[model samples]
Target: MTERVLVAYASKNGSTAGIATMIAEALREQGLAAEARAVGEVESVGPYDAVVLGGALYAGRWRREAVRFAWHHEADLTERPVWLFSSGPLDATAREGLIPPVPGVQRLVDRLKARGHVTFGGCLQDGAKGRIARMIVKSGRGGDFRDPEQIRLWARGVARELVKEVATP
Candidate 1:
């Protein structure tokens, strides 16, 4: 049977959503059934065989809706395969310096026994922010830092792992 995967995300300016969509596409390319949906729009994870949950970070915290979804779906998520990701660092090197996952997210990851947690570079748009915010980003961090190839590579790895899991036992 084909595994059904859910790629759900919470994004402020749509970057994380785009990443989630890319992941879902990559999984589909690998021949798995996958769907991408906003965290707020997902009412249940009951139907999915695996889940990829992600959110944008701000002030060192994931978006509230992502956190809430994890909390509300704790049991269902714990019974399925789960992977987590945070998309926020503006540069590749910046990803290496990210603080540990927030306690709530970490706790959920533990409960879900998630397969992995990845941090990916994020995009910053000059026009989306106020002048001061734009100035801060322009100081050195403004750009579309997301690498589609990297994202696709990670998604393919995930697809391989899921295939292996299904084959086992």
Candidate 2:
């Protein structure tokens, strides 16, 4: 059976949501059945054969809703192939190299036995909600840093791994 994957995420602004959409699209291109949904809106992870959970980082932590989703669905997640990602760096650090998951997210990785994880660049633009966000945009520090090709590349890698596992045995 083709793997049905869930690319779930918790994004404050629309950046992280965009990233998740890219991931799901890439997965579909690779021939897997995939869907991206807000972590909060997903009622359960039971229907998915694999999951890619992601959240935007803030103040060295993942969005609270993402963490909550992981814990709430821990049992189901542990039984399947899972991947994790965090998008929050406003700079080029994420694109230049690996930025390890923040402490809290790392804990979730360990607990869930995720197949893999990656850190991706974040985007902050005008009309962002918080005061700091507005300040950053006003100060000319805000712009989209997410690399769509890089994200698609990562998603394809994930699809390959899933294929390999399914073909085993």
State the TM-score for model 2.
0.98
lDDT of 2 by residue, 1-169 (tens): 8999999999989999999999999999988999999998899999999999999988889999999999999999999999999998888888898888888999999999987889999999988988988898899988999999999999999999998989998
TM-score of each model, in listed order:
0.89, 0.98
- lDDT by residue for model 1 (32-74), tens: 9999999988988999999999998776778889888888998
Candidate 1's C-alpha runs over 4 A off are 94-104, 129-135, 138-140
Residue 105 error, candidate 2, Å: 0.8
Q: Model 1, residue 22: what's the lDDT?
A: 93
Clashes of 2: 0
After TM-score superposition, the amount by which residue 18's alpha carbon in candidate 2 deviates from its true location, in angstroms, is 0.2
Q: lDDT of all predictions, in order shown?
A: 0.85, 0.94
By summed lDDT, the worst window of 10 consecutive residues in model 1 runs over 93-102
